[model samples]
Target: MKKHIIPTIAFALFTTSAYGQSMQVGFSNVTTVVPGGDIKICKARYGTGYVTSPHKNGAKIHKSSDKGHFIHITKSNVTLHHDVYVMANEYNMSYPGDKGEITAKAYVYATALDRKSGFSGVFSDGQCKGQLTISAK
Candidate 1:
């Protein structure tokens, strides 16, 4: 128990410190899934800086929205891998007869499955906060 506790504390401290760097990550505009050009963040569990959710869309007038995979567990699904953020829109864009203006977004595809990515950002984009994508060159 002593050994485990020591390591856990160290690990927590390390992650907390790493968030200060402010790394930038990018994700391809969700080729696979993105309801209403967004992803709903129904649930999020991570460190103080990170956040995730499953329900990315829906409303009272609409009653309900389509459901996506429940990514509560890390090993259960690959989609639930990196941190996930679902999204949607409240207002519609004014256009000349059916102009395609997709302001609504479902799920902000944040990589690394960490808390800092969703909880913090350079600016205010809400769920689509934090690094866009990061990878080895």
Candidate 2:
């Protein structure tokens, strides 16, 4: 009994410490230019897995008459060796029958950290964002 108890306790301690230090955290965002586009966003959190409802933390669309339109997404507490994807779309329209020929753009910002290092960056336009084929005259 004594021998079994000692081994069990040691195993528990080892696992606890290993998991405590093995997690990495990260954030990334990707945007697409439209009429129509596809956006893929990936974020990683080491050691500890992503929290439930990652997007619940913060995700939204912003529109302005002068600034146009944009989408903002944020995730927190992600798991290690795991990738999370987010999809979002945004658009705007001007006066009716005005032939809205305006150009659309997207932007993304993220912050992440790992057991070894940290990653924080921003992407815009044709950088990290993907452009969709828009049919217009």
| TM-scores of the candidates in the order shown | 0.19, 0.20
Those runs of model 2 whose alpha carbons end farther than 4 Å from true positions after fitting are 1-60, 63-102, 107-109, 114-119, 127-137
- lDDT at position 78, candidate 2: 24
RMSD for all candidates, in order, please. Answer: 15.2, 17.1
Note the Cα lDDT for every prediction shown. Answer: 0.25, 0.26
TM-score of 2: 0.20
Candidate 1 residue spans exceeding 4 A from truth? 1-18, 32-137
Tens-digit lDDT track for model 1 on 1-137? 11112232242243342112222223322221233433432122111122222223322112111121212111111122123422111222111122333333233332233444432212122343322332221
Q: How much RMSD separates candidate 2 from the native structure?
A: 17.1
* Per-residue accuracy of model 2 over 60-79 as CA lDDT, tens digit each: 22222221212222212222
